[model samples]
Target: MDGQWVEVADRVLVRRHAELDLSAGLVVGDGGCLVVDTRGDERQGAELAAEVRRITRAPWTVVITHSHFDHSFGTRSFLECPVWAHEDCRADLAENGAAARDTWARWYRERGDDGIADDIAATEIVLPDRLVTGVAELSVGGRRVVLSHFGPGHSGNDLVVHVPDAGVVFAGDLVENGAPPDYEDAHPLGWPPALDGLLGLLGPGDGTVVPGHGDPVDRGFVVAQRAEIAAVAELCREVAAGRMGLEEAVQLSPYPRETTVTALGRPLDGPPPAPGGREIMRARSWGCPG
Candidate 1:
């Protein structure tokens, strides 16, 4: 199923792509549909839009998981519909969209992937019109879908799509399946709790969890990954407190050395800290464990 939609639930579908091991979602309801994460570029988005049309003639609303180029740049093809994302997503796209495009394009071109690089360079960035500050409920046709911001994990603004009846959560980049969790724009201290909040959304019967990239996963997988991330978070604290060296933290991390190094370098995601440095403020906001 390289470029086809695989149904994980009755009407909830995921289209897996070989480009970046990317998976885009489609939730079909009685009178309408929901599209999750438009592909990478206008051409790719158009292809996805056409595929969505094949499965759903019902009007579709798009929700981006984060502001990463691959997940958001294709948004132009699904224009005129209300697009939803976290508020920080809008700011990220507005401020760094061009830079991301340039950086990725250059990287791709350097690797001899000029075709994809050209597509990235030519794509226009589209910002979400509907922003979710914390949590927002949406009705797709008559089906109930909830969008929630669990706190910063993969990016400053990570939005998750929850289809309650289906027990499937579109967990942007918060939970990666095929590769190590990205830390380039991540908050190491906050990531584990973000996963905790995500895990909380899963009921006893709920199992399917869709990652930003790779195949769908289950609660067991999420639980294990959460533990791994939590280990990294603890290592970050250890390094910060002078209890452990940076290389030692990297050596102990569950993820790769490079990934751990990047995560270790990031500041906790939030406004500038108070005089005392309130690291727990974000944890409290997400209701994370002390």
Candidate 2:
């Protein structure tokens, strides 16, 4: 609805913003508090930090769900505390963080959003200081929270934050609600399995799932989205192996054409490899079998 604290469970709150319809989370533990994501830039991060202060005076530890500019860029405002993320997250930021920021900054500027552009330009990239390759147990105010990098999916660095005590899962961009799945940097094949791991961790029954965007959802929602993801994965393999044509695959995909194209273009953990000469010529001169 708005970027206010909407409690999903005990001591767990998801703040949904209207800007990108993105959601960040706050978990208050007796020892300290855990901020699921920082936001897009310094200004937004400061605003979130202020709101968090109103809820609890506890010191905060940040768990970045991914390296995306929106979910991870707003860490400067929380420098007094530790920031955690998947180990690959650090590498992803180090490799492409500046370019990513510049890209968004220019996009906003071209759209006449100078203020947002300037804010993004001014926000220094804050890479996660603590890294987690596997399940890393943490304690915030005596309560336990687990951070796990299920596998390469939304990105090579997607991390899911689980609060077993609160029975809530902060499923970064792994499970989007307000929008279709973002496939710009996704591993379509691996995405489904990663989601499966999250499902396994949640282990059935009723529980809240705080997606990276939109309002928090339930287990059934994740299940349905996972099924769509599974369809995409199957289509990817079929298309890659030439058993399914791009246009036909697009027609059959669970998402829109553009989203399906982007998702199918990427294979596993990185960008699509350069097409061969024949492939390039075929695309430019004549259409391929469809």
Instruction: Tell me the whole-model lDDT of each prediction, alpha carbons only.
Output: 0.83, 0.83
Consecutive 10-residue window with the lowest summed lDDT within model 1 = 274-283
**Reference-based TM-score of each model:** 0.91, 0.92
Model 1 Cα lDDT, one tens digit per residue, 47-105: 89999999989998999999887789899999889999999999888977887778767
Which candidate wins on lDDT?
1
| Model 1 lDDT at residue 191 | 84
Q: Which ten residues in a row have the lowest lDDT in candidate 2?
A: 275-284
Q: For candidate 2, write residues 1-290 as lDDT tens digits.
A: 59578888898888877667778899998869999999889999999899999899989999999988889889999987899999988887787788777876776677677888899899898888899998899998998899988888887789999999888999998998856788777788889999998988787686889888777888999999999999999898998888999999999988878778877887655552221111121111222122
TM-score, candidate number 2: 0.92
